[model samples]
Target: MAEFLQFAFSGLTVGAVYALVALGFTLIYNASDVVNFAQGDFVMIGGMSTVFLYATGVPLPLAAIIAILTAVIVGLLLHRLAIEPARGASPVTLIIITIGASMFIRGVAQIVFDKQFHQLPAFSGDRPIEILGATLLPQSLWVLGGGLAVFVALWLFLERTLIGKAVLATAANRLGARLVGINTAVILAIAFGVSASIGALAGVLATPITLTRFDLGTIMTLKGFAAAMLGGMGSPLGAVVGGLLLGLIEAFGAGYISSVYKDGFSFIAILVVLFVMPRGLFGGRSVERV
Candidate 1:
């Protein structure tokens, strides 16, 4: 039971990060058909920037704000410089572009941050709280709470706000949205910015627990993408469900099986699920509009 609790806690921590990254995927996918592969780098930026700023004697809250904002700006620039020029390109081209962007971001991070791992103090302090006989750190609570908050905030923004509706409209039918005076190009940029911001926020919250390093975003990004797929592509609710479920799976797997095989098991499960339900459990079948 103790070991199971440990796995659950670790998995949820990792999964919270994945969920945030997956939300980034959903945001970009909704506004533009292209998936931003550099989404993980945004997480690195958040973590690295915060560590540096905090080290420079800046207040933690202010440093976190700046780090997240910088990531948002980077995201916007990625869309403007790379994605916009290649409009109407094939999925392979877009994928390559994003992959290139991810590589570029990591290269920059290594140069700027010196490839060192850094960690920050948790927002709530370094105390462990017990949950169902499991000892969980305050930092874990931040990660989990931050994820839920982002999810709720996203729901409200999308369902209740005109800007959100415009984003959804653009995602649903770019041509129709443009015809109706919804500047989909701008929406795409906004989506990238939003996605980056979310990723950055996740990084900031999780850094205390996971530590921060220059090349940290890749695994988190991959896990998050898997979570998004597990829940359903282009589905925000799917991302959340998928992230939480993946976390629980990893937790139980690590406890029951070998910790060394935890990551391997996730991919194996993804393969099995893909074979059974290609469209995802919650995602509907795709249909192109004429």
Candidate 2:
């Protein structure tokens, strides 16, 4: 039972990070049909920038804020420079462009941040709190809370605000949105910014536990993509469910099976889901009537 509790706690922590990453995917995919493969780079930027800034004598909270802002700026630049120029391109082409952007960002990070792994001090402290026969890190609570906060804030923004409705309208039908006076370009930019901000927040909260490195983005992106697919690509609720499920599977697999094959568990789950529910657990099949 203790072992189970331990794995569950660990799974929740990792799952929360995956949930944030999946949310980022949903936001960008909804705003624009193109999947931004560079989404993980936003996490890298947040973690690496925070580490660098904190090392430079900046306070932890302030450094985290600056790190998130850096990601937002980079996200804007990516939209304005790479994606905007290639507007109206084929979806495949846009996807390739995002992959290129990811590679480019990774290369720049290597030069600027080096190859060493970095981590931040926990928001509270390193003391381990006892749970029901399991120990928990204060930092883990921060990550979990941050994920919940992001979800609530996003729900409020998307459901209660006019600008948010404009974003959803743009996603539902870009031509119709534009016809109705919604500036789709602005919506796209805002989506990227929001996505980046969420990814950065995940990084900030997770780095204390997972650490950070320039090359970490690729794995993060893959996991997030899998989670999004598992939940239903365009559904926010689906992303959350998928991410937590994946995380729990991984944790249990590692605890019971070979740790070396832990990642294999995720892929196996994905394959099973694909075979059983191709549209995803939360995704509905689309139909059109003439």
Candidate 3:
């Protein structure tokens, strides 16, 4: 039971990070129907930029904020330079563009930050706290809290704000939204900014635990994409649920099964879920009107 709790706690910590990444995916997908494959690079940027700045004597908190802001800037640049220029292109074309962008970002990161793995100090000390016969890292609590905070704040923003409703309207029916005077281009830009910020926060929170590397973005992208697919792409709540489920599966699989193949678990789960429900757990069935 103690061991189970230990794994559960660890899973939640990591799952929260995945949820944030998945949220990024959902936000971008809903806003533009374009999957930004480079989404994971935002997380990478947050961690690497923070590490570089912190080493130069910046306070940790300030460095983190700067890192997130930097990612937001990069996201805006991506939209303006790549996505916006290629607007009205097929989704497949846009996806390829994002893949190219991800590689470009990774190559530049390798040059700027090198291949060395880096980490930040935990917001609090590195001490572990006992809970129900299990030990939990203080950093884990930070990660979990940060994830919950993002979700709640995002829910409030989308549910209560007029601009948020505009975004939602755009997502639901682009032509209708345009007719209603919603600036869809602006909404798309904001979606990218918000997604990048969330991804960066995930990276910042998880850096102390998972460390950061130039190549880490690919794996994060895959895991986050899986979580989003599992929950149903374009659904924020589904992203959280799918991420937590994926995390728990990985934790228990690693604990009871083999740690070496732990990463494979998500793929297996993905296949299983796809086989059972092609649209995913929370995905809705399509309806056609003739």
Candidate 4:
């Protein structure tokens, strides 16, 4: 039982990070219908920026804020320079553009941050709490708490705020939203910026436990995409559930099977979801009129 609890805790910690990344994907996809493969780069930017900035004498909290802001700026730039300019293009083209953007961001990160893996000091020190013969890191609490907080905040924003309603309207029907005098361009920009901020925040929170490197975003992107798809691509609730499920699968697989194939388990989950339940756990069925 203790061993199971230990794996569960580990799964939840990593799952929280994946959920954040999946949320970024879901937000942008809903607002703009673009997948934003470069989403993970925001994670890289947040962690690397904070690391370098803190190293240069900036306070850790302030540095993290600045890093998140930097990611938001980059996200805005991505929309303005790439996605916006390619408006009305094919979905495939937009996807390819995002892929290119991801590559560009990764290249730039390599130049700016070098090729070394970096770690941040744990926010609450390195203390472990024991529960039912299992151990939990203080940082794991931060990760889980952060994930829950963000989910609630995002829910409130989307369901209660006027701007959030406008975003929802835009996602529902871009043409109708424009006809109703909504500035969809601004809405899309906000989506990207918010998505980037979420991704960055995840990076800041997870870096201490996971460590980070410039190239880490690529794998993160894949994992996040899988989680997003597994939960139903456009459903926020689905993203969280899918991410947690994927993480648990990975943890149990690694603990019981072989760590060597841990990464393989996520991909396998992806395949299973694709073949068995393409719309995911929370995804609604789509209909079209001829």
lDDT of each: 0.88, 0.91, 0.91, 0.91
Task: For each candidate in turn, give its C-alpha RMSD to the true structure in angstroms.
Answer: 1.6, 1.1, 1.2, 1.2
Model 3 per-residue lDDT tens digits across residues 1-290: 99999999998988999999998998889888888899899989999999999999999999999999999999998998999999888889999999999999999999988899998998899989999899999999999998899988887878899887887788788899999999888998999999999999999999999999998889889889999999998778888988988898899899999888888997899899989988888887668686
On the 0 to 100 scale, the lDDT of residue 275 in model 1 is 84
TM-score of each: 0.95, 0.97, 0.97, 0.97
List of clashing residue pairs for candidate 1: none
Q: lDDT per residue, candidate 4, 156-198, as tens digits?
A: 8888999988888887888999999999999999999999999
Which of the predicted structures, 1 or 4, would earn the higher lDDT when compared with the native? 4
The deviation in Å at residue 254 for candidate 4 is: 0.5
What residue pairs clash in candidate 2, if any at all? none
Query: Can you write out model 2's per-residue Cα lDDT over 97-177, one digit (the tens) per residue?
Result: 999999999999999999999999999999999988899999999998998898888878888999888888887888899
**Model 1 over residues 181-248: C-alpha lDDT tens digits?**
99888998899999999999999998998888999878877888899888887888888888887888
Per model, state how many residue pairs clash.
0, 0, 0, 0
* Model 1 per-residue lDDT at 268: 83
lDDT of 4 at 37: 92
On lDDT, the stronger of 1 and 3 is: 3
How far residue 170's Cα lies from its native spot in candidate 4, in Å, is: 1.7
Given candidate 2, what's the lDDT at residue 133?
82
Candidate 2 segments exceeding 4 Å error: 285-287
